[model samples]
Target: MEFRQDINGLRALAVLVVVLFHFGLAPVSGGFAGVDVFFVISGYLMTGIVFSRMEQGRFSLPDFWLARGRRILPALLAVCATLLLLGWFRLSPMDYKMLGKHALYSVTFLSNFIYQGESGYFDAASQDKWLLHTWSLSVEWQFYMLYPLWLLGARAVSRHPRAPVWAVWAAFAASLAASAVWTTRAPTQAYFQLAFRAWELLAGALVFLHAPRLQASPGQRSALALAGLAAIVCSCLHFTHDTPWPGMAALLPVGGAALVIAAARHGLWLTGNPVAQALGRWSYSIYLWHWPVWAALAYYGAHRQPAAIAAGIAASVVLGMLSFRLVEQPAARLLNRSGTRPRVALALSAACAAVLLPAGLVYVLHGVEQRLSPKVLAIAKEDGNRFKDRVACEFHPGAADPLPRCVLGDRKDVRLIVWGDSHASAVVTAVAEAVPHGVAYYGYQSCPTATGVHYRGWDNTCVAFNEAVLADMRALPPQAPVLIVNRFASYVFGKDAGNPEPVPGVVMDDEPQLSTRPELEAAYKRRLIGMLCRVRQTGREVFVLESLPEMTVYVPNHLARALLRGERPDDVKVSMADYRARNAVVGAWLQEARTTCGVRLLDPTPYLCADGWCGGSRRLQPLYFDTNHLSERGNRVLLPLFRQAFGGLGARKLAAQPAATGQGG
Candidate 1:
């Protein structure tokens, strides 16, 4: 295949958008479409190579696999090896374990499946993952392994003049349909899985297979090329993290890439630009090295400022250039010069095994925590053990077990029913520790106390669970105090009040009729009012626990990383003003409920924050396991406040309470 400067320019464009998006640069929210562009480019180039070889009656699977190994392995190996060395010193034991697992999967071309099973691409924790970008490479490599065989089989079965084209189109249609359906039903899987993503490459393959018959006039070609560029630029600018991706939304960028490739033979200006060509030459290395650089800067707490980000970008560019020159180019020359495909393949396999051996050992040893001090290892271990004691008491949505055990006092009388989301579960530990009366902990992940509202990406079972909890509430004894708690700001104002945009996987449940923030808030108030009325009708007392001050950073992970760097954990505390701002809307609602429905409102902010700052840790012990959920020790610190909120339950009654037995339904 002849070198297409336009294609190289396209590569430049793709990598630029992806790098900018990763760097937290604004206005490129949909910059992730760059990966789709790369997918199409891979499809086009691979198809051209395979089809041309097949037509010449000289196609060899070993040769094709060897070429792919030479093209991809050298740069990827360099990145993996570098990350392994850095991660040993920089990452916490638990994080290092995860990194080792990811590295092991990545070396074996299985990172896509691993990541898909772990979390969504846009999740906050994904930023800490050093090799998250390799998932796409895994998907592409999986395709390469399958596509050639599929093509050979199709060629053997049919002698029709257009058999190859028809086969490609059929596969494209099937994969596109799967993408559309799976993106909505199982977005994380659709994003990472090769089955749903194959259509993108097949779309490019269609262009390659039909190139001979795709001729257009110079004027037509110019128009098509410009339209394609516009489509790409528009999607990159307008699409956001909230957009349901690789569904119909992906067509704009994928089609744009196909159009650009199809029209490049006719001389498009953008694809032939000098800057584009230069960037294109380094695109692969940039893609490989940029993410690790970003993740490392983030781990070191240097990514908060623009100067640090700029420095990281500059470093990425320099490293990319050097890798392309020093590693990728020479490795390719050395491998190809051998003139023996089997020998090259065997050598590449040996190199891959060499890398995987250490990665596997790391996974087996569970990150080798002995490298860190006992104190640091203890902190890292707390991440997994934080909520283990409370697990039996907390029930998941859709569970069919009997109600959770409510034992607390010696008398074992159920007087309090804690109901809300995961936030409530965290508080239950504190309430259980302080209150003499038994408390029934009825908490489900992401299921808020409000009725008639639904989070966009949450399972429908949350609605069922809320209803079940309401039914359970009706069964509680008269005058039982129902404690309601949640991360209310997240659902109401969304991360910030001034910019109340709906998060990607969280939207109004009402279909075909999206509700505005005010509308949703009003609906929530009404539901809460009705719930309060029902509880009061049963003569039960109601207490609404105000949402805690949310931290700007996850305390445990951030502090651990900071400790590794010998930095003060206190430097990352959240401001009181920031907390107050985020909770303003929910605080007002709680006030309204207190006034209108006669519910008692308990404010924990006074206990958690003071003197204009909300500290994330108390005496060097992390207050939270993550950004919001309080750690066990942190929760124990809040026991006195919880006791006071329960009508100053006397010390005699508190003393009468037995030690927690850790029994549950």
Candidate 2:
């Protein structure tokens, strides 16, 4: 139980890689493995504390729980409170609501579950989540809650002293197998959840139970420690965001950390260096403060600026130093001293409620929309509320009603049948309001509206959806237009820069080349053109919307940042040349259809782009809900264009639309 400076230095190593990885600095591509390293260290230290206390016959479960609560909750509550305060002035209603939910999750030690259902750990949207880093803390806290109970149960049931050690290794083996299999199939669960991560922490417990040899020479221990450090560095340098996580791959860092701890050398430069020890001491708070600062920078579109990243890192370290002195140290001193247990417990519950109650109010009040004026709220609108609900019929499958049953206009029988992916669904409300004809909408997320091609991992979902839509087109009158809409450039060039996840390669049923980019792009254009001609052959006219301009930043977030800074969010524009270049192949294929299949092309460029630039917002509203999907208000610009071709305007007129009202957030 003695203070091991090497362990402190190990803490430095873990936090350094994680911080560097999050900041997109240096070459620590696999820096996320640092969390694995910390798991090992915690297992060793906490197990040591529990067993040592038991030997002295003074161990109390409430006391153990209190010690952990004091260490984790104080500094955590500080970060969440600071973020909520900053969010009051800076975040849009939607993001503020999300932050409220995230804050509640963080303080309650359940963020891992919240994040598990949301998105991948390495997603671009991670920038929007101020408390995304708290998932690991939740994982560690879950382990802390369960580990000692398993130990006390094991000691009571078995006469053998070695029972818990055997149990730890047994659990490690079982968890390792499960982690590998689950990571391969359901990576989000493997990465963000604790079931797959328990083995790494248990490996550290094994290190404690089977202590390192005392007879080993100093030279051997130093060599062992250095080798452990090398293993950790190699994992960070060589692995990347795409690496399968917390599986067999994580053993490198977990094993490496266990070796460093077991080596028990306190004087080696790597483990004993002054800077290393300081970072180690401040590691917990540094981890807490670093992400919120960088998340703010990311919100303002400066995450990649070298100076901004430098400033963010500096700010995080300074904030960490201040938090350590003001919050972490004081809480540690008070709770570690003798006092009435119930008083400490009562105060802890009160602090949690203090943070939790306000967060709950923020979420329940809908991010308190009164924070912004009518003009700003107009741009923010249903986007700030539950937008997905409005579009749910198109994007989500209904058990009772078919997906295509989701119509845009009031009339049940539809003349204009819209077909595409979620991008198509996003424009339904606007399209319904713009056109006089009743619209039959069919949208499947991430599914390109083509007959023969699909994403590499996907089966026949998109192809099948397109077939069903084409059948509906065949049943309609010749005058009824079959509109083809999708985020087409994604099929050709992969996801936009602002999008998360590794690019899913396009695959064709007949292509000789499997998932190669060039071959896939060629096949995509061919299949798209073929589908349009097929629509023409179905005896219906085909209208294709030119791909909308995609922004490099999530539009709502950018606009909110701009407005918070007293700048015009509508002033935002992206390079038109760049948009044209990104979709050059798509445009060419659509143009080819005009001659080969009589398909008409409608360009969103005029509505979204002007003077060699594509804007994310206009005078009244932001153009997009996220990176590429147009907001309902923003998509209203397309109503004029759609009306010109389809020949009917709905009851709602865009110009006559009233401005949205607001509430204080």
Per TM-score, the best of the predicted structures is: 2
Error of 1 at 351 (Å): 3.0
For model 2, the local distance difference test gives: 0.78
| Steric collisions counted per model | 1, 8
For candidate 2, write residues 559-601 as lDDT tens digits. Answer: 6667767885455568988888878877888899898989888
lDDT string for model 1 (1-665, tens) is: 99987789889999999998888888888899999999999999999999889889999997887788789988898888788788889788767888888888888889999898777568767777889999999999999999998888788899875777777888899999999999988888889999999999998898897766776888887888788878888889999988888999999999999998888644666777777777899999999999998988887767878999999888888898999999999988888787776778877888888778777777788888889877677666656545554556665544456445444443256657778877887778688767665676776767666655656566666666666666665554545678888888877766432345553224444442555656666777676566666665667778888888777666666667778888766644678887787778768877877888788988887788888987768766677887777878777767878888764443333222333232373
Model 1 residue 244 distance off true place after TM-score fit, in angstroms = 4.9
After the best TM-score superposition of candidate 2, give how far the Cα of residue 431 lies from its true spot, in angstroms: 3.5
- Single out the weakest 10-residue window by summed lDDT for candidate 2: 656-665
Number of clashing residue pairs, candidate 1? 1
Model 1 — which ten-residue stretch has the worst lDDT? 651-660
TM-score of each model, in listed order: 0.86, 0.87
Q: Residue 391 in candidate 2 has what lDDT?
A: 44
TM-score of 1: 0.86
